[model samples]
Each structure stands twice: as C-alpha cells, then as structure tokens.
Target: MTIVDTALHDSLRVLKLSGMLHTLDARLVQAQAGELGHLEFLQVLCHDEITRRETMSMQRRLRRARFEQTTTLEEFDFHASPKLPAAQIR
Candidate 1:
C-alpha cells in the first residue's frame, strides 16, 4: 500500500475530493497489486465522487422541501384504500 502524505491528504480535502480520499488506500493497494489499471482507478474515484454528490444533493433538496414524511408508491398500503386507484397509480 502507498502512504499518502499529510500535504497531499490536506490537498485532497481542500479540493473537496472526499469520495476519492475515502477509498484511496484500498485503490492504492489494488494498483500496487496490479489489479487495477491507471484509467480504471481514476474512473472508480470519479464514480464515487459523483455518487456522493448526487446523494447529498437529493438529501439537501428533501430537507429544503420540509416534508412531514417521505414515502414511495411502493410503501402505500393498497389494502387500506381499496376504493383508490392503486393500479392506475402504479
């Protein structure tokens, strides 16, 4: 495994690369073992960052909406509302 210097670690944090930082050690190990190609390692890091941002964005939007409760169509009890158009909603 490669050792990440304090300077580089701080740089990554300053640059807001939390997702990549989180998995850097494991990825480094894979790279050292020749399990991951250079491009693939970068791709994985980018994917992690993208997924993290998307999830955070969604949560922020939901909090801003101030909904009393969040529920999906699948969570709705069809049996509780037999008169409602559950099939059509689905």
Candidate 2:
C-alpha cells in the first residue's frame, strides 16, 4: 500500500476498533462517491502518522454510532429508548 493507503487502512482499523463509523450515513458511503472519493478522503487524512491516529481516534468516536445500523423499527425503538438497558441497545 502507498503511504496514503496504509494510513487509511490503519485509520479505518482504529475507527472500527473505536466504533465511530456506526454514526455516519450508515454502512457504505454514497454509491456515486465511491473509490475515487475514498482515495481522496484517505489522502486528505494521511499527512502524518501521529495526525492520522489522532484523527482516526477522534473522528471515529464522533463520526458514527453503532445504533444507526439497525433497520428494524422495533430494534431502532429499543436502541433509541433511553430507558432500555445498555446491553439491549445492540
């Protein structure tokens, strides 16, 4: 992998580890803005290893939440309900 790709891969790993992408638009990004945009986004983030890890950790936390992945209304309701036990949020 190029530096960009390597950094992006690492950042992505960290994001997954930290569970940040759960909040974004959910799942895959827009179909039209695939590969090329992905590469650009990675490049934009790959400036330095320290910056990359720091950003990955920060954005990963803020970018997405795991609850967004639910499609079922019942599951969504339960996840959204603050009264529900934390364990059941999945």
In lDDT terms, which candidate is top?
1
Residue-by-residue lDDT tens digits, candidate 2, 1-90:
368746755776676533322322222354235743676544433433445468787768755765555455444556456787756555
Query: RMSD of candidate 2 to the true fold?
Result: 12.3
19 in model 2: Cα distance from truth in Å?
Answer: 11
Q: Number of clashes in every candidate structure?
A: 0, 4
Off by over 4 Å in 2: 17-90
Task: Tell me the deviation in Å of residue 73 in model 2.
Answer: 19
| Candidate 1 error regions (>4 Å) | 1-4, 77-90
lDDT of 1: 0.85
Per-residue lDDT over 1-90 for candidate 1, one digit per residue giving the tens place of the 0 to 100 score: 225556666877999989878887788789879988999988988888888889999999999999999988999898998999998999
